[model samples]
Target chain A: MPQTKTQVLKIDKLSKDFGYRQVLKGVDMDLAAGELTLLLGKNGAGKSTLMKIISGLVLPSGGKISFKGQDTKKNPQNLRKSLGMISHQTMFYGDLTAEENLLFFSKLKKVSSPREKIEGALHRTGLRKFAQIPVKTFSSGMNKRLNIAKLMVMDPELLLLDEPYTGLDYDSIEFFNDYLAEFKKKGGTVLLITHQIDISFELCDKIAIMQNGVAASHMKTASYTYDDLIEEYQKR
Target chain B: MLNKILGIASIISIALVGYLVFFWAPIESSMGIVQKIMYIHVPSIWLTFLALFIAFLCSIGYLWKRAEIYDVVALCMVEIGVIFCGITLITGSIWAKPTWNTYWTWDARLTTTLILFLIFVGYLLLRKFMDYGEQQARFAAVVGIIGFLDVPLIHQSVTWWRTLHQPSTVFSTKKNVIDTPLLVMLLLSLLAFSFLLAFIASKRIELELKSRKFQKQIANLPQDHH
Candidate 1:
């Protein structure tokens, strides 16, 4: 069987359960290139589980997931190489300097010219000045910036962010939004899970509202109003 | 660079201790020249337990924080403990030949040391069965913590039970059993062996980290099919 072209990521009949509680039930979705898809729902909506499944951190109980027209089940590591993720965890050694952190991740990603790539990522994330400081001394916003820098070191085609704006101040959030705008301009794809409706409205190309493990509604930015999404979310 | 310097210093100290044990220290009149083996035997046994204790600490740290470096440190310590255990066994056997009129004995200290060696072997074998990355780390940490529990048992078995073997004299401050020259030789050998243990552990950890990096690269290759 042949595959479609527009789908960068495809999840079909995906269900996950922990013991007797089914967190996701027959969840289906498709993400296309150059699209910033915002996944929104209340707490315990299985947003993180879905993201983890796509990132190859966790396997679904029942589902088929494809990345770039390749079956993720058979080739998860290869598929994972193309993904960059930012979660609540910093995922870097606190004692290492920001540059060292970036270098280590770049090495893990097998990037050629790791030093140059790390330097470029630091510059892009506006973390060049603090590159020599240990991450333990960094503020939460600064650490988030370094986390973004580490992700960029991989040059991943698919970027996954789970509550990336959770602890950021207004200025930091604005800075992150500007960075995402530029990231999308360069034909990058993003799957972001957040509860912040205002940021979703301003930044996302499409909004996917997940409830009880299924994507209840997926609409383009022009198709759904803020009130419409809120109503749909509450109704579920 | 720091490791290389430390390695050189350990080698020099070990050479000095070797000279002191062979030529400078006095031989006991009771057991004759065989008693001189205490300089090597006691230090090796002490170092083996020390390495295992460090492994235990590192395993606890790894489990508490899930840090990869702590896992590496624990793994390195296990290998060092095994090497020191082998040395302890060899030196003990050498001393046994002249004193006990045999190459081996079923004494409590000897039996416990043998069991400790078996546990160290089992730890390495368990590590071999595990796959790479976090799973390998977690499995190794569990094994390390369990394997280290044997060290204390090995140390206490001589005192706790009536055995033909002598009790531990490594930490004793008695003046009658060991004279000043033999004591100094044992202390110097202990210091040298501990330094050597740290040096080898550091090198092993570096190699382990490099191997993990290589494995990750191999996993990422497009043509290498899983």
Candidate 2:
């Protein structure tokens, strides 16, 4: 059944090196349309590097990535148009308002008719009331929510979420969980990097554990137990 | 090995320039031995313009090619230009005290040259403080290109305005404006300074690359050892 789903992203033998240190050795993974895949790994397993490469922010030292069956190196416009990245880093103008931030990113993403979408995003993040104020004045948790709001208007096909729930309050995390469910229902593919494995087990359709800079195992969440995942994760 | 060769050659060329400037070139009727300052001052100005022009070109190349090499080269060139600009200002002020009767003046050419120096110094400071990744490189490229536009204006300030500084005689189209020996000595000084600039740039770029490698090593370090 997983194989029958339309494959949205394919990465084969991806490797990245920073000087003499090899961060990613040879990573191969697949994400299908409408599937929310949770990527689990211990710290410094090159999960963020893999996400950066997928989002076209960092070029890999070796290997290839295909988006919608097209080589990303040749057809980077496709990656730009379809990829939405959410990281802890909010690369927004501190002086700009929350609404202004979304509008700016929407324009960069070439989102048409972003007016209503911006409002919708602001409302979803529960920051509509604070949209008129500058982002520098907002709390850390508020900034994280605004990050989600920006991605909502991007209309991307594949979402790369890295530590999205790091600074969130309890209510915001619940809201994000529901938002992910809704996004999946709309046929959006997601590769989420998070350490909250128990909560993620209920949301992610499949779990991919990374070890030694490679995707060590992929298992169906429905068929695998918590103990099975821990056993496989500890194999590193 | 090549840098060592460049270093020795640069030292020899500079010694040759010092000999020609101090002993061979005829002294001006009015300025006397102080006229020798022109030999170093004029060439420093020329080398400053040359360095900034190269930085401008490399900045544009970085924007177009997205190559880290271009960024490194551009930053190095900017530093060289700033150093020469400082030399030009200091030597000009020293010359000014004896000839223009003051140590400093706000004339058109002097003001424009000072602005050029400030702009590139700002470029260096921006690189020093900011940069999460490639963002600083992009910002510096934009600043380098815009700041370099001040160079041509500084060159033409003498012609475009009534300035206290003397009009450029070395690059002038008129014949016999400067004595032939003086012009030759100035050209030789430029050649010597250029070799020195190139040598510094080569070493600076190599060190910068090593520093970036170290920074990447830190960035890729594990969040926790356990």
Candidate 3:
């Protein structure tokens, strides 16, 4: 079956300057609907900054970002409603239980039928047993699961993940891989930043390497092997 | 540019006020030299009202608009209001020590002002300890709005109850409540402090906004990773 994918997000000449230092110079990329894109970059390549801008956390100094054919600056509320971000920070109250955290975030996200949605997310993430326990008691892997549950509850069309595989264990990574596969099968789009090259190549439909604050190269996963991707990252 | 103009105006007016207060204003027969403190004290309290009112308005704007600029302005105004409120308390107590024979009193006006000060001080402390972002801004805005309840109470406290504090003179309807020279000087002092408020507020807001971005920049600074 041959079908053209719709372009959901368009980035053109994106630039970010943190005072004197220029972080993102002129990055351009397009993300199609129902495709998982892995953004690979080194420590200071502005991968996190780009993610932050797309997620509406940080304002870009220059350039344009369009989501669903609408200028993101002109329609920020719509953009926020259409996307969810998972960053290194927990972004949750530690004192709140897993269920409590979801309920609180659900209201913030203005989700319909919050209780039912939260219940399903907890069970799906395999954290139903610890639903009543405070999030501070959860380990790093559990926190990652909670973040995934948050995305499920948000039910956004796009997901922006920053260094999601930084500290995950084998089991957590496996769970994440399975969940991502299921999500992609259901037509969800994701822009993720990760250094886990092997799993990323297997999961991502396309790969982008950001170097010196620009999308240096973007290629299809089927067109490039794992070693080629690693070389691209190191060379950049 | 407006802030700079305000800064110069404040300095010039305050210097003029110093000259007039010491040389031209009448010497009270009863309070004598200590009564001179009223020039600074009254204006401090008046400027406190103005600063806190601005904070309250900005707080409402923040909650309604959910804009970061509103939050920044509200935070700066609250900080300025706290400083003036502290001055009011200290000067009022200093003047009261000789007149009322006590450095502290439980009068409604004094107590209300103190409560307002503490609330805003607590507001600053909350921001200091809490995480920075939308959540912190929302919480601060709520506190700023609720803490403003004491402003009106402080205004009517003297009228609502019999207290050692004097009744409203500047906004009062009573005739001959104050001499023309003293009234003119007090009004001029108020103008000076208002300009000062504008100047400080602009600077604080600028600093706060830049410091926040700088903090984020430092946190995101790149380390060597291949």
Candidate 4:
């Protein structure tokens, strides 16, 4: 028997350069539907730049990126609706209440019944009581949860997260893991970028190691033990 | 190379205009050499408006296309426009000292221009304070569009209200108010300053592109020593 999965994203020979220095050099990756792929890299491995290009926030200097069988360069706006991103910076407005932030994004995304979606996202993220409070007053953990709430309201087919659990506490981390599992169960695709391998080891279905502007290797988590992955990283 | 050629052309034409204004363009019957500042003042004001108009157009393009190149051009033009606006105010003040007997006045034309300058100053400050990316570009483009609405208002202020600043000479219905030599010099000054604006804009845009590349390189540098 063989496992076959639908490919949600296809990145071929993707390369990005900044002046004399090249960040991504002919990198190729494929993310399948309902799969959580952890992209592991050391600092400055060009993970964030790759995610930015995928989300249409940045353009690649060379190569191609196709999402859902459509070239990103040709149909960026159409592709944007299907992709949600959580990066190092919070995309919410600090002066606006948590509910207001969600409402604003929902309208931009043209979600149906925005009011209902806002309430539902807040309740699910466990921020119902703090819905009316300004985002500036929220704790780091609370803000991270609100970012997840943003993803829920949009209900994107693909989610790209860059260092999603950087400042989260134990409880928040647990909550995030549970949310990601549920999201995958609903047939969503995820490409999580992180330098910390231990944190996302169990949650990821596959591991792709990025080195020298390329994915050096990709392996299934089931086939490789924790120590085996570490040894592999060292070899690279 | 184009920028360099434009820069040289600007210098030559500006020097030619200066010689024509001081020697060839005859002094007015009433005002003497003080009227000469008009050669510098009017052209600076015209070029300022031109730069701002380009910025407005580029801003619109940036919003519609969401391209980084358009945003870079808009930012460059806005910065150049502000510099020209500053030159206009200072030169106008110098001309006013002997002609109007005061370096400063609260006349409608002067006041509206000042307000316009202040608005653009705020625009530049907004760009400076925000982080660079799509959000910054979006916000700046919106501000650029709104701030440009003041240009027409500034142009029409002298007509809408009775001001000590004289009404349009070249654009007025009156026939040949300015002498032929003065008109030639003014037009040449306009051409020279416009060239200068283009040259500066291209240079600034080059710097902007380089700085963006540098920033990314710095970001990719290793953070932890260990």
Candidate 5:
């Protein structure tokens, strides 16, 4: 009984170009509420560009992006307040402690009771023990964990993650999956970009495969086999 | 409420000092009636430099903390400094016509004032070149701090290298030449100028915030057509 057209995000005729190179051309897609959508592509695919456009970090050359029935182009700041993004680069201040970093962004987002939220985020991320240590002192996997904690503090309506499992160990990946499962259970929409097909199959309810600056295919998780996707990606 | 009250107080004090400068303070025997210009001129120059210094400090703070509000304050101070420096040049020219027998001179103070004017012009130009938001602020903050370093050197150049300009007498404790009435007028002008700087700076800060929001809107326009 899911409403297919109850779109949380709608992108139409999106195109982006850099000089002579076209990165995204006439890409169209839709995302629904409470659905975890996995974006699949090789290294040169325009997945990151599409996410940047959605997050208000980069302006598209041409297109319309609407979120929650409002035009993202008209209300980027308000959209940004509701959208949480975690990329490969941990966006926290290196000189500040984990708790301090969360506290600062929380205030920037104008979240009330920031200190209490910081403590809650730290506890959820299992970094409560290292909360006082500077982020620069943490290992790569630990830093990513803190990044997740930062996103959790905001409680965003839409979460965009670019390669969130890049440097994690097997145990950390399991921990991340558990957190994501809980996040989806709470009705938070997630758009994840990753090269790993197994993770996509295990986590996503819907999948979009991009190639040559456009979405090559969009299908339900059950419609395509893992080998079929790998073959389709290899052919392009 | 406080700023409004302060603005009114400054206006009243400036009026009283203007009366004192024209009537109560005695004209100097050497420089004649034109010497009275210093009662307003010197204090404006001093306050301008003081405002510039505050701007430099605020710029440093903005860069270090990456706060948008600090950049607003720095921009305000730079604008106020430019206004005062303009006044300094005009009043100095007026004073020079009767005292030095020329409307303009390449004296150290005059040269330094010109340089200070250019520095603020560059600061404003730098802001124009930037696309706005955090990068513009960081660039402006760095330039503001570096530009204000010249202010102290400019003030000292008259005394430091034996220039044709007279050294500071009001600030020097060893041989101050200002009389009591003239001193009171100068002090009152100083307070009045400071209040004016504060009032204008606050207004400019509001404008900067508005401009930032407008720029964001303009940048987002291309993406709405699809």
Candidate 6:
């Protein structure tokens, strides 16, 4: 029998407004430990806004965001150490080589003697050969892989990815998929935002569709067929 | 709308101040017509300092509050401050050629001012090259706050070191070095330049805000094809 996992994050009645525009309206979701959830939405549906709020990059207009049983607002600095983010933009320093960038972030995360961890992450990303190369010289696909490597080295409990597959080669995407599989096996939680639902639906355990700043529909990945999701998505 | 009103007001005041400087204010007995350039030169430098100070404050506000509005305001101030500082340097160079017999000097005031200008220029370059959003904003804010350390040093340079540049006449505790009419004209010019700074900064900030919104709209557009 399958076991239910503990809740790792709970977002309650989250609301965010940018000036006169309301981006998130009463968004409520619970992310369970070890479950990979795909957030699907049309354009301007506030999916990125929800991710930003979860990562503490943007503050919500009203609501509570609790991470690891504590309010994130109460101790953001401490909470930040346990969270890693990946987006279209690379957070690594272009001036630094891949190894150096990994070392720097690992040190910031207070990882003990990070050299071995850095090597392991680089090896996992299949970037060990290019570890000495400057990140600015890397291609877009390489940068995306390095971003995942950086997150791996940090070993965050929760990973928030926005369009994680935007500019990856098939081989790179396969590599990331394997990593995600192992990550979920180890009880790590992931909340991913992507428009490429056809490919992502395979790995996702749950699906949440956002429409006009709220969760319009949510279902288990096994319960809904790919056509069912596409039908539900179109109805929104 | 406010920017337009401020822009027209500034243009009128600037023209009026120019007329007063050349024709109404009594010419200096020592330097003649060349000394009149002081009216424009001093005010530009003053406005430059004012803009940077405001930028410094806004940067701090951004870091504390994590508000994008503060970041936009801080960026506008830095851009305007750099332009006005450039004017100060050029006008000062022209004045130096006639008064000090050279176009350049290693004087403390000039050296410190140049360094301040270069630092802000670096700030702008960072903004241009770095990826936009929260990460860029955080790094820029830290640099902005630290770069302001040079401000106090620049302000005190002339008094701290022997230099060809004259000590501030308007700001000095010493009895007014400039004539009564010249001082009046200088005050008027300062007012005009302050208005000009306000007008330009507001316009630039408005443009920045619009560009940001446009980028957001583009980002939100459906990428189903991807």
Candidate 4 on B107-159: residue-level lDDT in tens? 55666678778888988899889876666788899999998976677667655
CAPRI-style quality class for the chain A–B interface of candidate 4: incorrect
Question: Higher-lDDT candidate among 1 and 3?
Answer: 3
lDDT of 1: 0.79
- On TM-score, who's better, 1 or 3? 3
Candidate 5: tens digits of C-alpha lDDT, residues B20-104: 7787877866667887778668887887888798889999899777666888889888888888889999999998887667888
- Candidate 5 runs further than 4 Å off: A1-5, A221-223, B1-226
Tell me candidate 2's fraction of native contacts, as a decimal between 0 and 1: 0.00
Superposed Cα deviation of residue B138, candidate 6 (Å): 3.4
CA-RMSD of model 6: 7.2
TM-score winner between 2 and 5, please give it. Answer: 2
- C-alpha RMSD over true interface residues, each candidate: 12.6, 5.8, 7.4, 6.3, 9.5, 6.7
> Which residue segments of model 1 deviate by more than 4 Å?
A1-5, B1-226
What is the Cα-based TM-score of model 6? 0.64
- lDDT (0 to 1) per candidate: 0.79, 0.83, 0.83, 0.83, 0.80, 0.84
Ranking by TM-score: 2, 4, 3, 6, 5, 1
How many clashing pairs in candidate 4? 0
Instruction: Give per-residue CA lDDT, model 6, range B19-61, as digits (tens).
Output: 8887889988867789888888899888988999999999999
Shift in Å, residue A149, candidate 3: 8.9
- Model 6 lDDT at residue A179: 85
TM-score of each: 0.51, 0.75, 0.67, 0.70, 0.53, 0.64
Error of 5 at B173 (Å): 44
> How well does chain B match by TM-score in each candidate?
0.86, 0.87, 0.87, 0.88, 0.84, 0.90
User: Where is model 3 chain B poorest over a 10-residue stretch in terms of lDDT?
Assistant: B167-176
